[model samples]
Target chain A: MTYIIKTNNLTKIYQGKEVVSNVTMNIKKGEIYGFLGPNGAGKTTFMRMLMSLVKPSNGEIIICGEQVTPTSFELLKRIGCIIEYPVFYDKLTAKENLDLHCEYTGYYNKKEIDFVLDLVKLKDTEGKAVKDFSLGMKQRLGVARAIITKPEILILDEPINGLDPIGIKEFRNLFQKLSKDYGMTLLISSHILGEIEQIADTIGVIKDGKLIKEVLMEDIREENTAFIELKTNDVKKVAFEISHTLGISNFKILDEATIRIYDMKASEGEILKTLVVKDILVEAITRKNHSLEDYFLRIINGGGMNA
Target chain B: MLKLIKLEIKKFKLFNYYKGVLIANLGFIAFLSMIYFLERNDGNIPFENFEMAMNISSAAIRTTFIIFAAVLIVKLIIDEYKSKSIEIMFTYPIGRKKILTAKLMIVVAFTFIMVMSSTSLMAGLLYFAEAQFDIFPVELSFQDIVRNVYVNFFYALATAGLSLIPLLFGMRRKSAVATIVSAIFLATVTSTTSDNINLFSIIAIPVSLGVFGILIGYLAISKIEQVDVI
Candidate 1:
């Protein structure tokens, strides 16, 4: 697939220190790419580079087939962005704010404003003043403003930073719907892994200004490592008995009463049978898998899964 | 470029503070008229009284005009800086210099219109009241009134121009309060003491203003182009 966004050795420095080191990333067209990282991990800096907000210290970014430069207005025209906290004029109504954004985007259609407002489920809030909006509502409004012009690519940095669960769900649903219906490419960064996992087609993990991993959702799911968790009173005895009896060693004792088996050869039934024979009454047995959060933390903590 | 200017103007309108400013200007004129009526003695004042009123009003209006103009300019620019919206704004399909120029132009244009409209309305009201009440027997000709109008026009424009100094400072400091205080301090010191200082007096205010504008413009362009917006 052709990449819509591509970067080569992109870097950013602040106060004689590199905030984003030499990094390269590729975002395919018509896919939702999730940028996962910790706070101040250079996610926002990368997005800014894509949008041409800050001049890259070295290297290049290509968005929508246009090379990003110091003043690449044409390239930026097709991109929508919310770098950090979405800020708008408090005195204006939602529609007025959208209208101002429309002017800058060169999309002057009044009908498009309502269309975007409805898309973000903010139709009823058209006339409500922005100052009175809740954080979630403002976030929804920020998304609405970003998509008002039907931009080809949406670059959102922590779009759901302060959103509640319901707001996050709504945003996920909105993003999924937009990607499916409009085929717009999205590059979103968020610390909330579950939300990103739910909607993103591809995942990128960033740490210390470097792209640690990039993989498709399907590939990650296919190669997913199963985590079989077992809880019993005698965790050590059970773990030793299971390993010795079944000849399986790819297991971890998660806690005093829990053992997590990563190997697939030791079937749950066979292991339970062996445990029963050993007189280790397992209180609970659960077939678990690595969550996106687990995967993110694993990668961040230098415990990355071999996907 | 025009579209971006339109967008910048929309931002100014969205804030709605400028509307209140217009209302305050009208209200101030009404208050001044009320005070004039309260103090007036029917058909008896000398020409010296009219001259005294003009002088006092000139100083008051000049100071008021300059402060308001600077405040409006600083408000327009500093708000964008404070909210980090400048980062978002500069990403649009417009040159950075063009965006700054548009914002500066809009603020200057708005100040000019408000000052002119408020001053003319106040002048018209004063002339009408004087005609009706015959409070001042000193018969001022149309030419004299027109000359005063011309003076008011130049004065208002000059006051508006004076704001450019603070605006340059505002762009550099990114602080509205700093712009105001610095502008006030400089204007007070320079305007008051220039006659005492032979060198300053010899240069003339207009010449100094022009030179300052060029230097400040250079500083603004350099600073804006290079400073990282985070």
Candidate 2:
């Protein structure tokens, strides 16, 4: 597979501390690569480095087959980005700001400006100054500007920071359309795992300045471990019966009232029958599949084991 | 580079600053013309020394241009840093040096236009006051007008160039107050001594400062690629 964006040992040091340390990842062309991490996990710092907004302390960034250096102006022309919060000339109107952005990028199509504004649902702003805009509106305008040129690659840092549910859903659909219809590679970072889970084809989880895991969402879904969870009254007696009677070692005792069976050797009916026979008062039992949040939390807590 | 500069100019909501500068420039001219008129009316003041009038007028206009340039630098460069808008500009495909150059060019050009226009307006008003009131005994000549225009143009250019000095300090600290304060201080110092200096020194001092400012500006631009955006 051809990679549109690749980083090798990308690191960023600030005042003797490595905020982003030795992160190497590949983003395939036309794939939506979601960057998932906790707050202060160096996701923004790494994205800034890729955009060349922040100089990397050490490592290499290859974008569209060109190494990103301080002088990578030509390479940057192919990428659209919103680093942190969107900023604009507050005095200028929304349309004016977008026009200025187009001027700088050497792409000026007046009709396209209206199209993008419509895409972001800012079509009726009607020359309102940006300072009067709400945070959500500004974010939509930022997205409009980023997509105005129809760039080959898009890098957004917390793009949905202040959007309402409807706005977020619209942006989700817009991102999907951008990638699917235009074949544009996207690298988006968000602290909301569910948001990234819904749209991202692959995910890169970073923690403590390290990129701990890069996994395909498809694989994660396919390899999802479904387990039986039981809530009971006699927790000790239930644990003994489950292990001694069921002969299943791949199980975890969650709490005083709950036990999870990861090994699916026996059917749910058999397990319930065994528990009932032992008089373990099972209050409730349900089968559940491991979610991306669980996978992410496990990776974060376990130092990247089985990612 | 020229296209970048043009884009920068277009981005500026010129009416906001231009209206203020125009009113202030006209007010300064009226105030200075009144002072000249009053001074000539006094018997002790020499009315035939056109050089002194030109020198005083140039000093006042130069001070005004200095402040104007400082405000422009603050708005164009320092405020961008404070508001973090420059981060967006930095991510663009254009070189950081080009952006800096465009900002500097706008400031210099604005200062030049404001200063020269105000200086000419003052000169014309003073001449009309002389003709109407017959306060000054000196007869204004074409040679004097040409000399005044030539001297004021160079002086305004120099003032505009030296405005970059405060820009350097402001950009280094990313402080608008620092930029404005330094410009006020520089203007006060430069304006006070402008009266005592000979014509050669008036041209040389600001010219040398302009060179220094340009050097500092280049230094700032060179560092733009390396510095981390906050």
Stretches of model 2 off by over 4 angstroms after superposition: A230-259, A263-270, A278-286, B40-42, B46-48, B127-135, B138-143, B193-204
B107-195 per-residue lDDT for model 2 (tens digits): 88887788788888777876776678765667777798788888777877777778788976787688988899999988888878433
TM-score (chain B only), all candidates: 0.75, 0.87
lDDT of 1 by residue, B80-101 (tens): 7887778767877767777777
Global CA lDDT computed for model 2 = 0.85
Which lDDT tens digits does candidate 1 get at residues A1-307?
7999999989898888888888788999999999998888899888877777778898888887778767677777788888888888887899988887777767768898878788777889756899999888888888998777778899998999778888788888888887888899999998878788888999998888878888898887766688788999998898789778888888888889999998888778988889998888899888987776666687889834432
State the DockQ, from 0 to 1, for candidate 2. 0.82
Model 2: lDDT of residue B44? 61
Every candidate's fraction of true contacts kept comes to 0.68, 0.89
Model 1 ranges with Cα > 4 A deviation: A227-266, A275-288, A303-307, B1-10, B14-56, B114-154, B186-203, B214-218, B221-226
- Residue-wise C-alpha lDDT for candidate 2, range A206-293, written one tens digit per residue: 9989999999999998777899999998778877877899888888889888888898998789999998987779899999888878
Docking class of 1: medium
Q: Which of the numbered candidates is closest to the native, going by highest TM-score? A: 2
Worst 10 residues of 1 chain B by lDDT: B193-202
